[model samples]
Target chain A: MMHALILPLLFPLFAGAALLLGHRLPLPAKRGFSLLATLALVPVALWLLLLAGDGQLRLYAMGDWQPPFGIVLLLDRLSALLLLLNAVLASFAMLYACRGDDERGPNFHALFQFQLLGINGAFLTGDLFNLFVFFEILLISSYTLLLHGQGPARVRSGIHYVVLNLLGSALFLVGVSLLYGLLGTLNMADLAVRVAEMDAGSAPLVAAAGYLLLIVFGLKAAILPLHFWLPRAYAAATAPVAALFAIMTKVGLYAILRVFTLIYGSEAGPLANMVSDWLWPLALVTLAVGVFGALASRGLQTTIGHLVVVSVGTLLAGLALGSQAGLAAALYYLLHTTLVSGGLFLLADLIARQRGALGALLVSAPALRQPLLLGLVFFAGAISVVGLPPFSGFFGKLMLLQAVPPGPDALLFWPVLLVGGLGMLIALSRTGSLIFWRAEGEPVAERADGLRLLAAVGLLLGSVLLVLLARPIIAYLQATAAQLLDLQPYLAIIRGGEA
Target chain B: MEAVLAVTLGVMVTCGVYLILRARVFPVVVGLTLISYAVNLFIFSMGRLATGAPAVIGKSASHVDPLPQALVLTAIVIGFAMTAFVVVLALRGLGELKTDHVDGQEPRE
Candidate 1:
């Protein structure tokens, strides 16, 4: 029945609808409902994962409408895998947020559920305009969450964050419009077919459209030069909010990979190559700047924010390499970064709690119950971020390096790679020492609930599991990459109308 | 002729860049709005302009690309939402802190 295809989105959608009634419920009930609803997503996600492994694909059309006219939901191995991750991450983060002594209000739970709806919708929607609608839903919920707690700094920074993203959304709209104008359809599969049929006279227009689209995606992904808004925004957002944002970049990366592979493969246009080439140096710069920003920050939260940027930069570099092997590495690293960054942000929140508040965490050194956990988490995250081994990061980089053909300029990549690695190490050393080791002057306080700690552990341990499961993961990534390169299957689905 | 519109858009972008670089919050908001306008126009231009053709499709006649128009329509609505949100945020800042500075009153050392 392909029910697996619809469950992930439906679970969130129905849960969110129920949440609109949650405001009338008691706070405890509201929190309970949200957590239960989020946890309900897990089983469906797992089933979808199973279906994806069996080489099954599902496409759901709105209101029995045909493609090139109506919105569509597509389920592929890549989308299923990411959808599951989003549900799992959100469930854990909700558990963390809804825990005792810090229970969020009804609106918080409602907004959170809707946020998941938007995020999952964005991941699964095959129609570009539908993607935009879902992005707005996600962004709007995020804006509310970002400014949920009342404070001058959060409120102020929240505005800036909203403004910047609003601009990105506007850019996204423009890009999508241009894409629609060039082609007759906003359906991705249709666009892909039409894009491949472009003649020389229309080539420049297509290229421009493609580049503009990349710019919008790149900004959302926090690729270098467009990243000025990230650290500040992440630094100021509450811990759970920041943790949710940790995977937002994955959405952007997902869009880039999806659009380029599905609609604008190498043969379709020069835009793909141009984007890949242009991103390399900027990614290196983003890596450098992020590491340095981390080094410069005194607060655990701000430092971790910078670290997220560095990982994003590294992912972009891998993405820009534009080979199946490189994409495989990128896919692996993308999952790794989401887990590690999500974990570290949780740790940062815990550390912030230990110091009383984020501002206090910056001024006073926190004494954690398991001080060793901080160091251990930092070590694993740093190792992964820096591409050091026994971890998945090293193996992913190894795959990427192996894929770079023996071009004359191949040696040039090494310096940027080395410097980025070193920068990661330096940032880790500074922030780790400052937060865990050298800040002994402050009074030790009772740590927060164990659920936050558990969420962090879950994410970190899951990443270590990724390292152990590298063989299967690499196989899956390659399969997805191959699927991407062959657009005929995708074309047939949207065009053929076989349910 | 279209090149001149593109140039005007470029100049608007430059102005936005200068405003975004400023330290005041209001200027930054203004800059963001201007940048969005520029982006909207840029996207519209990418469709490769057609003469006096409406976006709606007809059975026999050629229509200017409707997709870009649809896209631009969506962008304009979303842009307004963003602008409204930003304006509300800026107004909230004015009401709460009574200042429009980029950095909050709290000092970072």
Candidate 2:
């Protein structure tokens, strides 16, 4: 099963190509095939997770070429966890898409698979340039996916998203090229080694490149100032696309964590802990801004979009702590937020569909066809998202708060995070009452689709499952964080390969 | 030669940036194309300016770094595809909203 390391990337690649070629096939067949491909990833990701659980860094050099010269995909605890997350989220999103969303545009299933391929490749790749390529793959697929349904709002947002990300891509190449020029290698491990040994004379240039990369990743992650694009783009995306996009921002956070910890980490003299000072203040403001946006938003989808930004802010805060506990807390919270936010997006879509012409706007509309069930799901999601007790969100936030050592940073983080949760609580409750309680008219639409509800509830249940399996998951994440902070194994992998 | 290449890149990027800031989609697309061109040149130059050296080894005593050439190739292809997509998207936006303005409406005069 050593070859299974490449399966995550290949399954999607082949499946996407097949779907594109067979685009004329019946929708059921395409759905069945796409669902099968996506479902298969779960176990594959699980197996990869089990493999990575053993604490050994697994490297799959493309075409059997060695690292520092050839491309390599690496699997460790962090990548495995993210792969599993993406697989699970993609599975649910794919399930939801099967209920007619895939038919909205040409090649939705193919684009989705390509998106997964890019995301999976990104998590697995250890080469900087390869990461850039994967980013483009995911991004291009995302641009099409955003415009999948073809609406005025989507085009407007799509233009901004495409143009901005194109610039981001240019910046990404510039940064990668700068690093390659300075270090003469694109392999991440080799770069880490070289960056550490780099003299002070070239420090400023490397720092510029590092910060440039940060800006690009920050744009992807939607950190505060660069975050204006997110709510519009995500809100304008179709439901399943929006659900899948919950993992997209995490990819940015993941890159930040990966590059900062691995390359510019403690061992990199003169460049050590460079992102910490910048990440801290930005995270606080992002949290505050996201909450404010959520509170002010008129539509449910946009509210959830802002909530995604809030999650980004919270996760960045956990990462900003710059400790093993902090990373572990952030990873756990990442699992919770990605799933629940995805569920909320799907749920919001369901609500929008039932509102007749009202369509996700927060105004009082006709009651939903299945108000009781949806309201229950909404209540549950709200509880989890608001960081209330007994759900994964509460525990995730608790872990993050506890992870923060008592310091000025804690003082800043505790209030901003707690208050942000309170703000979410207010926003969600207002939305729920307006949609479910304050309604005076009859239910507008027929009973909701079983598959769609299942898809949404299935993902929302992920939060509960996280709470159930909190012990082992948190333990694994702790080890992952420890592994990330401990650069020796990663650096040693290159040395081992060179020998 | 290096100074000239650097100046050209700077000029291209400046033009790209200026055009991108415009409210119109056509200008924005043109700007993006320019920027991608500048970025491609920048990546190519990262290999340093070498006129006569062969890219492949064994044919010459000193070979130019072939890596950035490969990198630039990949970047160009991706950039080309993106430009095509954005252009089509711009046309679609024009059809749907009946405006070339990025905001999907004519700015109030």
Candidate 3:
């Protein structure tokens, strides 16, 4: 069963390779194979989640070689939870893609599988360099996926996306090499231990390297200053791809949580909690800016893109609190936001498809074919996104708010979060009325695709399910956060593997 | 030797940054290529700038660290692929948008 740790990576790798090789196969066959491979991940991820729930750290050393020498995949509660999240998101995105989106471009299924391979690999690997490799894998796939249905808008955004990430990749290597130069290892657990015990002479270089890694991750996570590229790129991407990218930002947040908590965590002298102070202000500003962007945006997808930034800000605030409660809250919020935002992207696409020439712009247009059903889903998504009651978003926000120890930080967080929610409420309401009510023409005759509706609704239902399953899910996340904060089991890998 | 390497890397990075800031796609591509070169050199030197030291162990008492060599190889391959993709993307953008300007149109004079 320990081999299950590598299954997440292998399933997608093999599926993607086969899809690429079998390109000449009929479309139905390709979709079946891709769908089967993706759906298989859900069970594997769930089993891994169950295995990790036992609180034991499982290490799968490649080729029977020991850690700190061979690359290893470490599975604990956090990684397992993220793996499941990626699986669930990818499944629906794959489902959505199967509904004719795949035909818009060549190799959609293959590129998607490869993207999953990258994401799962990133979440699973315990080595820094391996994480970088996985980032490249996912990113290259994404670069192609973003341009699937080639257009002027996509290519324009793609240029910015490609150039920025290429720079980010260079910086990632610089940070990794600097750390390797100083510590003589790339395994994250070994790096954690060595960083803790390093002499003062090397501390500055290590700190520099750590900050460089932060910049790279921040670029990926789309933190405020580095976030300019996200809205354009995401909005320009095809719907299913945009929906899948909802988890992509979280990958950066996950790296921040993993690397900072394990390697440069409280146990490290002089470098303890290095990112906390910076994350606090940046998260707040990101929230504020995201709200303004959402309110000001003219397109539905771009508005949702800004809302994604808002969610990132909210999650960053939870992480900035640097508490067990905060981390657990962030993890829970992470699940809600990723699903709901993804649903919104798909829903927007569906609405745009029916609107004909208006096409998701915020102006008044013809009513959608199924106004009542689509309106209901959009309303539910909007309320949930704005952190209103009766959905998972409210609870996620409430938990994060409750986790904040009443202090100066609380003073800053409460107003920004509440005001940001209010702004989103206004933006969404205005968007809803214009698109749903203020129609200038007759409703389009063509109906929404049944499969596309199912894909979107299924994801939106994930949020409702989160509310219903809040207790068990929150408990699991709490345990996951606890495991993350307690780094002893992780550090034990390098030592135990040597024996 | 260290100073010379440092100076060369610094100049490459400076030029790369400058080129990357240009409004045109071609210079930006060149800039990215140059930066990747600088980064590769930087990673290579991180293993401590050994001359004639075997990367493989058992060939000498003190072989160079083999890890950064492996890392640089991966970086080079990835960078090369990315450069190629960006070039094609730039050409596509040029054809579709009818402008070499990154913003898809030239700024007004």
Candidate 4:
């Protein structure tokens, strides 16, 4: 059963290698292999999820070396859930990319596979250095994929994309080295145990290392001030690429959430106090900036990018609350935000095409203003994005609001939450007015095909299901949060001492 | 002992920031390179700057902290790859936009 933990990590890596090998095959054969490999992942992911439900955490030592001596891949409930989500989204994105022009479609699948491998590896790895390695794999493949088969604009944006992440990766390396120097281990669970016993005098160095690592996560998550590369990159990519990239930002939030919970606790005296103190204000600032950026968008794509920022900001704020309830809410918010953001990006593609195509198709028919079915879908998307009730976004935001503590100066989590909600509404309002309500411009002539539309509908429905199933998810999240705070289990996993 | 490394780090940060702020991407790349070097030295010193100790003990008793050195060695290799990738990305940006600004689409000179 423990071997099941390794499947999510190994499956994608093997799948990507297989795709590279079959790259020269006939188109039909290539598609079959890629789809089959991705489809094969679903049951495996489900199996791992089932295993996690049994309260059985799996740790596979790389090359049969013991923990703290060799790299490890850990599969707790949290990692299992994230790994499954990453694979599902990747497979769906691959299917959606099948609609692309031949020049871009085949190579697109290969990069999708590689990106999944990197993302899953990042989620599963137990060592800090290995996480950096996986992040590089994700970044490099994404860089190539971003530029391949796009116009000069995408190529240009890819430069900013590459430089930003490349710089982040370097900073990550520095942080890892410092951390290893200070703690004598790069294994994350080991570091957590060892760091607990470190001298108070060495706090400054540890704080620097922590901040550096935070900056890396911040860059990837597109938190305020470090998010310049995101809007342009997202807006310039093809629809499927944009959709896939939306989830990529969530991976960053996942890392930050994972690291903070695993490495530090709010109740743990001076060091924990310092981290929480700094994060709370930074999170508030990030939230304000994200909402402001979201409000500033003139286009649907940039608006979606800002939404990514807002979701991350909210997640960070939830983390900053530094309570068990806060962490659980953050987890719920992460899941909700991933679905909402991914759906909204795909909706942008649909709207763009709808406005453009209806303009062309209804050229002489002046009486028919909007494409009825498409406009209805856009309306649902707009409402969902704005966090209206009965939608997944609403539940997540509500949970976050309840979990956040009142500020010291005033009881004020609601005011900030309201501002963010308003910012989302205004952004979506502008996009809706421009795309659907306004008279159509020249037809885009670039409508999504059947497969793309199917994926979009399926994703939206899945998010609704997520809201319906919130109770169980909340229980799981609370359990995960309890485990994180417990820390004894984490220490035992690495040292084998308590066991 | 502490003051020299602090000054060196400050100088590296200054030069790196100056180079990164320049209009050309190469200088920015060079700036990134300089910053990384300073970062490495700074992180190395954070191990508390002990000397005459090898990371690995040669089947004998004298063993320095091996982890940071191992981490630094890997970091150096990864940093080189990162630098190489950025250089190639910069060249690509230059070829595409006819300028070397890392921002890539800044109003052409």
lDDT of 3 by residue, A308-341 (tens): 9999999999998889999999999999999999
DockQ of 2: 0.86
Chain B TM-score for all candidates, comma-separated: 0.85, 0.96, 0.96, 0.82
What would the DockQ be for model 3?
0.88
True A-B contacts kept by model 1? 0.59
lDDT by residue (A1-499, candidate 4, tens digit) is 2677777767668877877877887777767677777777778887877777766567888888888888999888888788777667766666766665334745656677778778888888999989988898888778877776656778788877876786787688778877877787888888887777788887778878888888999899887778778888887777667777877887887788777777765533346634566666666777777788778765678777777777777777887776788888887877777766776677667656655433212122122233565667767766776678888778778887888666661255677777878887877776565555455344435445788777776666666877788788889889876666666677778668345
- What local distance difference test score does each model get? 0.75, 0.94, 0.94, 0.74
Listed for each candidate, the true contacts retained, as a fraction, are: 0.59, 0.80, 0.84, 0.55
TM-score of chain A of each: 0.93, 0.99, 0.99, 0.93
Model 1 lDDT, residue B56, Cα: 74
What CAPRI-style quality would you assign to candidate 2? high
The true-versus-predicted C-alpha distance at residue A192 of model 3, in Å, is: 0.4
Error of 4 at B24 (Å): 1.7
1 or 4: which has the higher TM-score? 4
True contacts kept of 3: 0.84
Give the per-residue lDDT digits (tens) of candidate 2, residues A1-499.
Answer: 2688999999999999999999999999999999999999999999999999999999888888888778999999999999999999999999999999988888999999999999999999999999999999999999999999998999999988998899999999999999988889999999999998888898999999999999999999999899999999999999999999999999999999999999999889999989999998999999999999999999999999999999999999999888999999999999999999999999999989999998999888888888899999999999999899889999999999999999887888899889889999999999999999888689869888999999999999999999999999999999999999999988887787778
Native-referenced Cα lDDT, model 1: 0.75
DockQ in order: 0.45, 0.86, 0.88, 0.51
* Cand. 4 TM to true fold: 0.90
What tier of docking accuracy does candidate 4 attain? medium
Query: Candidate 3's error at A383, in angstroms?
Result: 0.6
Chain A TM-score for predicted structure 2: 0.99
